[model samples]
Target: MRKPIAPRTIRGRLLCPRVDTRTVDHLADGLVEIDEQGVIAAVGPAPAGCAVPETVPGTVWLPGFVDTHVHYPQLRVAGRSSGELLTWLERTVFAEESRFADKNYATDVAADLCRRFIASGTTTASIYGSSHPIATAVLFAALDRTGLRAQVGMTLMDRDAPPDLCLEADAALVACEALIARWHGHDDDRLRFCVTPRFALSCTPRLLEGAGRLADRHDLPIQTHLSENPGEIAAVAARFPEAAHYLDVYARHGLCTERSLFGHCIHLSEPEWGALHAAGAAVAHCPDSNFFLGSGVMPLRDTLTRGVRVGLGSDVGAGRTFSMRHIAASAYDASLLRGARVGPEELLWLATAGGANALGLGDRIGHLAPGYDADLVAVQVQVSDPADTAELLDALLFSHATEPVRNVLVRGRRAV
Candidate 1:
């Protein structure tokens, strides 16, 4: 049997986005108390009679990064770019995914995936499994063992792909139902099952419709790709000729709800932007993957201007690395290329608080606060001896490639 964790208080020089706003809250000296339930019971400077706090383990403590989109099976496929998104999928991605049918192979990779998440300082995420249900099950079991909070989905691809990788809509839904029964709401709801259609080009109309209805019945979150590439967009148009636009194809099948998360929305039309805002949906801006695959830069400003919820996604395999901080660094580059001046505070928010909000877990896990889960990272990062918030953020993001995560805590439990 597992032993109960003891409650403790820790002091730190911390910086995190506010739970109520995008602003960062920094304290050169601060204290936080985590209760037996693994919730932050108190957080602030020492009050009178608040037992002298223990020092934090790293240079600064920030809320753990939340990755809004990524693929579990593609962990080993990073950096094998084949010129474009669709061609890369055909040449590099699907072949790697097909190996997941071997349960042993899937299990080994899942363990590595969890380690990478911990090493990179991600406590919460939305992940994609390969089309195989057992492979997705393998992914969930690994996440559960590691104590990470994530929403995982099995990719649903019924048509327009290789036969070995494709399963009919009804069969795929049956597989999904089984996975849901086993993993949904497991372990005090730390993990959830998301409905994932592999986009319009890969899914049959039946698969898309059934996925939408299943999510409605189960009240689950949904994740899928959107207008990331122009060629891919044209193909989606050809595949769903009757639909109004790329986003409308999802809307037609009831998948464009507030619970939906669309990745790489680069070439969205004005009306599509309006629709995303009106539906109260969210977006996963995978700038690293966009640049890696020659997919055009997403107009980050357009998504922000529409007041749509947006979060950073590593979008790995194609996206270079699993670190969301690296993705945040790339987001700045993408923004600069698009002629937008997205601030460091905002980028920090997007990597942590904004991602949790995008995943609809804002109050539960985003920022450092009393009543929030102690899901945070301790990074050994510094540009100045006692770096201010801006200097700290810049160093953390810009030096992400080398500055490793010093410590990680999930619900106050040490995960690394």
Candidate 2:
């Protein structure tokens, strides 16, 4: 077990997503008292009977970013591309993922992935492991030691994949069940198990249905890809001819629930958007990946107008950077490309609170309010004027692509 953080109070300049509004709350000079259990005990001006606080200058305290979608096995594949989605996956992605079948390789990569996440200021993430169950187990063990919060799953694919990477349906389900028994809700629910079907094109109906049953039996969240590319959408339509659209394929199998997180809704029609809204499912809008692979921009306004929950994803390998700031900047550009305007507050919310809310972790990790986990990132930023929070944030998102994340704390224990 990881060592516990000692309870203490911190005083700094705070900028965080407000619980009830779309904007951020700027406590220019504020105090946050953390209890022994690493939960926030107070927020605002210093409480009565407090000691002289330790202060850090030129630093801004914000909620550690929550990355809703990332592929653990693809960390090394980040800048490599094959022009588009399906072809890219076949040529580069699949070949790279096949390396995870080696347990030693998986362990080394898992440790490196956790280190990069911490360095990039991502506190919580929903991760996709390769189809190897032992490799997936290695990932969980690595995360357990690193102290990052995550929901990890073994990618389930029974067809349309390399033979060594695909598992039979029965064996896949058994592996998932065993993984859930061992890792789900482990470490005070900081480490979780997500049932992942690679996507409709790669998974047969039997495999998708069995994956849904496992998610339902464990009441776990489900993560998978959706209409990411035009070619991919057409292939799903050809594969599931009985379904109305791509989203309907998983909906028919009971996978479209509030806990379902569908990555890349970039090619959806009106009816498909309606289905997602009706199902109360969330979307991980991977603008960076879309831009990198020449996939069309996601219609951010239409999806939000339809009342579907949405968050940003780095989608690394396909996504160019691990920084949530880069994701937010890309999302801002994608929104403008679609003729919609997105403010920095909204983009920051997507990176932090919106992601937590989408993943059903809203009440615990998103904000710095009382009773919330003390997961925070301290970034070194110089603010000459206190009222320039908006301008400061704008520069941070668009200009400071490689800003140093000075410290990262999960449950008040420093991780980086």
TM-score of each: 0.97, 0.97
- Score residue 328 of candidate 1 by CA lDDT: 92
Q: Which pairs in model 1 have colliding backbones?
A: none
Candidate 2: global Cα-lDDT?
A: 0.88
lDDT of 2 at 181: 94
RMSD of each: 1.8, 1.7
Say which candidate scores most in lDDT.
1
For residues 1-416, write the lDDT of model 2, one tens digit per residue: 43566887888888878877657888877898888778899889655665746466667788899888999889889988677999899988988899999999999999998998998899999999889999999999999888899999999999998998999999999999999999999988989999999899889899999988988988999999999999999899988999999999999998999999999999888798888998899999899999999999998877777767787889988998888989999999999999998878888887888889889998998898998999998877755674688877876688654668888988888774
lDDT by candidate, in order shown: 0.89, 0.88
lDDT of 1 at 207: 93
| Candidate 2 residue pairs in clash (backbone atoms < 3 Å) | none
